[model samples]
Structures are given as structure tokens and as C-alpha cells.
Target: MTRTLEWNVHLDLSEENGTTKAEAVLDTGSEKLMGHGVARCNPQDVDIPTIGDELAASRAMKDVAGQLMRAADREMEAVGAGPTKGPLGKPYAWTDVAG
Candidate 1:
């Protein structure tokens, strides 16, 4: 059977003291996942707000992706499907992981 679901993501950003911070939120209907990241401007480097925003936002998105993977791993474990194991663990099926 084919299933379809929609999830929404929102981001919040702030800058203070030469540092840019970003927060990513993923709403999965049943729960909310949060990811945070920060970027600091070096004293010798140019102070570009847009660059900092991009860096922080990228990091925050990466964080959210990692959290989503971990949640999926937990769900697989609950369903008697073990998580994948290797240099970088993942939750996808057909991995080396043995259920």
C-alpha cells in the first residue's frame, strides 16, 4: 500500500555579539523535533551577516536531519528491526544491520 504524509519545518534565526544562531523545528504531526546551531565571526574575518546566516542555518538543518535519523532508529528498534551499524550508523533497511 502507498501512503502519503506531510510534515512542516520552520526555522528561527538570531544574531548577537558577532554570533549567529539558528533553530530548526520539524513538526511530525505527533511530535516536534528541534535542532540548534551557531556561527561566530572571527575577529580577523569579514563580518558578513548573510554568510553567517547561511552557515548557521546549514548546521541547524544538519542537526535536524540527524535527530530525525535517530528517531527512526528508535522506531525500528521498537518494531523488532535493529538499526544499521557501520562507520556511520543509519536507520535505513537493507543495511548490514541484522534484525
Candidate 2:
């Protein structure tokens, strides 16, 4: 079986008082997930607006990725796939077990 699905991700960024904040929203039609990040510019470092924006946006994307993974794990467990800790201590499917 083959299937195609499209998920939409929207990112919003803002800066104020040397601090940049970012929010990532993932829309899966059936559900919406949100992630947030913030970046601050130090007085010693050069004040670059783009750099702060990039850093905050990157962090927000990472947050969203983590949220997506957690959602997937929960769905997997609901289907009785069984959840286990992977080598890196991440949630994973456990298919080998005795009933």
C-alpha cells in the first residue's frame, strides 16, 4: 500500500530588546503542534539581526521535530506496537516480545 500526505509548517519570528523569538507551528490537518525558541544577543558580540533570527528559527524547528516524534510515539503505542527505549534512549517500537 502506498499513500501520500502533506503537512504544513509555519514559522513566525520576532525581535525585541536584543532578543529574538521564534515559534513553529506544524499543521497535520487533524492536529496542530507548536514549538517555541528564543535567542539573545550579548553586548560583547556584534548585534546582527539575521544571526539572531537564524538561531531562533533553527531552535524552533528542532523543537517542532521533537514534538512530532513524541506524537508519533504516542500513536504507535495506541496501536499496541509497544514502546521501548532505543539505543539513544529515544522512544521506539518494540516488536520482539513474548505474549
Candidate 3:
């Protein structure tokens, strides 16, 4: 069976304070859950840094992904599915690149 998963993330940015807070929601058609993360500037009152944004977004997504994987694993286990090593391994295909 093919299933569709939807992930939604909301980021609140405070440019003056150099801080960003993110809330993430994952929906697996039948169930939904939430996660959150924050990013802050090393120096207060500076413009938000790109590195910080990247870090926080990545952290939030990682948490969501982990949760989804766990849920899938549990369902598979219940169905007598054998555990597969590297079942989640995949390569990225980028559509855009900067020269």
C-alpha cells in the first residue's frame, strides 16, 4: 500500500533579536503530531544568521523524521515485517544549483 505523509513547519522570526522559533507538524493521513525547535543569534540584537536558521530548521526536521520512522517501524513490526537494515537510505536529487 502507498501512503502519503504531509509535513508542515511554521517559523517565527525576530530579525531584531536574531531569533527564530519553529513549530512542526507531521500528518500520516490517519494521525498527526507536533514538534518544535529554536534558533538564536550568538550575539544578541544582531541580524539573524543564516547558519542559525539552517541549524534550527534541520534540528526540527530531524526530530519529525525520527518520530515518523518510529511510527512506521512499529506498524511494520505488528504486521510481522522483517527489520531491514538501511531501509531509509536514499540519495538527494537537487533541482537547483548556484554556479
Candidate 4:
């Protein structure tokens, strides 16, 4: 069997008071996942808009990746894959779920 899929990710960035905020959205025809990130510019460091944007965007994308992994884990369990740890066998549960 062979399968092909295309997932689209959209990143949005904004800056306010030396802080850059980013939101990355991953769209899969059947579901949409979102991640958020923030980057703060140190007062002593040079203020570079591009740097902040990059940092925030990267963090947000990572967040989305994490969410995707966890989602996959949950789906795997639903399908009787049995219990398992995170990617690479590390225990992982978002703060909210862990609590």
C-alpha cells in the first residue's frame, strides 16, 4: 500500500513591547492543530526584528510538532497500540493532562 499526504502549516508573528509572539497552525484536511510561542528581546541586546521573528516562529513550530506527536500517541492507544512513552521513549504529558 502507498499513501501520499500534504499538510500545510501557516505561521503568524507579531511584536509588542520588545516581545515577539508567534502562532503556527498546521492544517490537515481532517484536523487543524495550533501552536504558540513568544520571544523576548533582552534590554541589553540589540533589537533585531528578524531575530525575534525567527526565534518565535521556530518555537511555535516545535510546539506544533509536539502536539502532533502526542496526538498520534493518543490515537495509537485508541487503536490498541498499547501504552507507550513519548518520542524516543521519554514520558510525556502536557501540563494540563498531567495534572
Query: Which candidate has the highest TM-score of all?
Result: 4
61-91 per-residue lDDT for model 2 (tens digits): 9999998988877988899874665655543
lDDT of 3 by residue, 37-83 (tens): 67787764555477666766776777787888778789888898936
**Position 90, candidate 4: lDDT:** 55
Point to the candidate with the largest lDDT.
Answer: 4
Candidate 2: pairs in clash: none
Least well predicted 10-residue stretch by lDDT in candidate 3: 90-99
Cα RMSD of all models vs. native, in order, equals 4.8, 6.1, 6.3, 7.8
lDDT, candidate 1, 1-99, per-residue tens: 999999998999999988999999999899999999899999899899999999999999899999998888798888988554657544357755665
Better of 3 and 4 by TM-score: 4
Alpha-carbon local distance difference test for all models: 0.90, 0.89, 0.65, 0.92
TM-score of 3: 0.57
